[model samples]
Target: MEAFWAAAVGIVWGLPLVILLAGAGVWFMLLSRAAPLRHAGHALAILSGRYERRDAPGEISHFRALSAALSGTIGMGNIAGVAIAIAMGGSGAVFWMWVAGALGMATKFFTCTLSCLYRKPDSQGVMQGGPMYYIEVGLGPRFRPLAMLFAACAMVGCLGVFQSNQLAGLMQAQWSVPAPLTGLLAMTAVGYVVLGGSVRVGRFAGLVVPLMCLLYLGGGLLVIADHAERVPAVLRAIVLGAFDVDAGIGGAAGLTVKEILVTGVRRAVFSNEAGLGTEALAHGAAQTDEPVREGLVAMLGPFIDTHLVCTMTALVILTSGVSPQAAGVVTTAQAFEASLPGLGAGLVSAIFAAFALTTMITYAYYSVKCAKYLFGERRGGAFVWIYLVLIPIAALWTPTTTVNIIDTAYALMVIPNMTATLLLAPRVLVAMRDYFARQEG
Candidate 1:
């Protein structure tokens, strides 16, 4: 039964990511007249809120929504995901990650803008939006089933297995705490917030995200500062490896140039989730009438996740003189350990705990939005219960099991959302063009 479910998830989660992210990124960059790239300065300026004030529409501010979504993406991926990519793929993976981040900017802008425009109050009368919203409203009633499928998968993916894996991994590496214990504690803490609903989740994220980001970044900076001499060589290796045609790390089977490019891109997509449409739910709740302003703010997510936070993790791991190939988590821990000695692993463990908890609270908000939309309030609690219970089950599992389950769930959610995004691409373009035209005038 486990294997059956695993395979089902793999098929659903795996295929959509390729077509949706890689394909759509390529498509939007072309169609937007290279807007994400050409108007990079504009995107950054808008992110700074130079054009719009904080007194915009929905519920929370743009800063809060980005923080909430960043809390989700910036968690394990910046740590473990980078570890795996560097270990299996090579340092070259970091370069491809940067490429993915650059292209992801436009993707995020389109999906987030559509999220607000199509949003409506759910059966429970809460403001709701996401891939599901676009799938149902933009694609119309003909696609409602697909929308439900996407929502269900996201609840399981983000709130359950993903957070479980993150907490479990961090605990095992940091304090040698058993995964089951960590998972149980994680489950308990998450249950408290999820029951409180979206407003509570938003409030929680607004507080947790900033503190966690600073703590993690500060630790990473300490490590990087100690390894200052190796910085130039590490940067050079990353750039050279990005284009090297030969398999340098693992010989013929290790990591080829092609594999590095593809996997890095894949991991980057996983890390920031810009085009996936999940973060749209959090941003959609923003109290803003100007959809484009929200979109502009949303563009900043990848920069924070991939550009800032992920960069720190990548550099620390690369420059620590540890081999990610031999020991994934331990290698990363050692990098920190080299700088802080005994406290390195423990520090990272705490960061992971914070990251996992924040991710759970934020994603729960995303899932509840979809739940209220699909089943209304009556069945919503049932869905939450199922997710809350799965947290410990996920943590208790091995890393491989946890990651596979997460991958499967991710694919399932992305398929419907990506398809809807494609179908609604014209609307996004029209909105962007119309809004920008006015801004320019």
Candidate 2:
């Protein structure tokens, strides 16, 4: 069952990169007039609270929403995903990851803007928005089923499977802990915050995201400083390897430029989850009337997730002279251990555990939001409980089986969600333009 689910999830999640993101990214890039690239400084300024207004709507602040989403994305992906990318895709993968991150900004803008536009107050009068809401509201009654499908997939596939898998992997690698035990401990921590609802989750993310990022970045920088002399050569190797005609990526069903570009971008999207409409679920809860405000905050997720944290992992792996030939989470573990020696592995393990647990908890809130949108707020508690209980079981399982299942489910959720976003994107774009024009006035 796990294997079956994993394949389905992988295909569902994986197919979008080739079809949805590839098409939507190219199209949105032109539509936004390349705002993500050209006016990136403005995006940064907006995130810095320079444009914040006191009269915002919603539940929490835009900063908190962004932090919640960032906390989820900037986890194992920044560490392990980068490791896997370098291993499978080579040093060139990092370059492509940047490309994906850049394109993903546009994706975030369109999807998250729509999230705010289609948002509605919940039974408790809390602002609710995400793929589920947009799917139901934007697509109308005829499309309600798709919305439910997405909600279920997100709750089980993302919140339950992927989160636990990553968290368990970190724990197992770090202390040689048993999967079920670590999963139970991790789930217990998550349940404490998630059962308290979005406010608690948001607050938790707001605090943890910044602190963890600083610690990880500081540690990574220390290692990089020690290997400063090898920096230039490492970069050269990346560039050269990317274009290597004789690097065995060409001849027999091997990687071409397009393949490399696509795979890297896809992985980056999965890692940061910027454009996939997942993070927007968390960010849509921001207390802001202006969609662009949240969108601006939302843009920071990819930058922090992919550019800063992912870069740290990449550099550590490259500088440590670690072989990227391993599978699972070990690739990253090896890199960190090699660089820092005795303390490196333990430190990386702890960081990964922190990141994974935080990510899972934040994601649980997201999935709960989706569940509430599809069912009722009352049903949410039941779904959340079931998800929490399943974590330990998932952790004890094979990593391949678990990740594949979660990945496949992730893919399944994205398809309907992506289609909904593409259909309603014009609405978002119009809202953005109108909001910006009024602000300028």
* Tens-digit lDDT string for candidate 2 (324-437): 343322355665566678987687667767777887888788777777776788977578887788778778764676577656666676678778888887787787778767
State the displacement of the C-alpha of residue 390, model 2, in Å, after optimal TM-score superposition.
Answer: 2.2
Tens digits of per-residue lDDT, candidate 1, 124-184, equal 5656667787788888988989988887777656655766776787778767889988888
* TM-score list, all predictions: 0.86, 0.87
lDDT of 2: 0.73
Evaluate model 1: give its TM-score.
Answer: 0.86
Which portions of model 1 show Cα errors greater than 4 Å?
12-16, 37-56, 159-162, 165-188, 245-255, 322-330, 389-407
Instruction: List candidate 2 stretches off by more than 4 Å.
Output: 1-7, 13-16, 53-55, 176-181, 236-255, 322-332, 395-405
Provide the clash count, candidate 2: 8
> Which ten contiguous residues of candidate 2 have the minimum total lDDT?
245-254
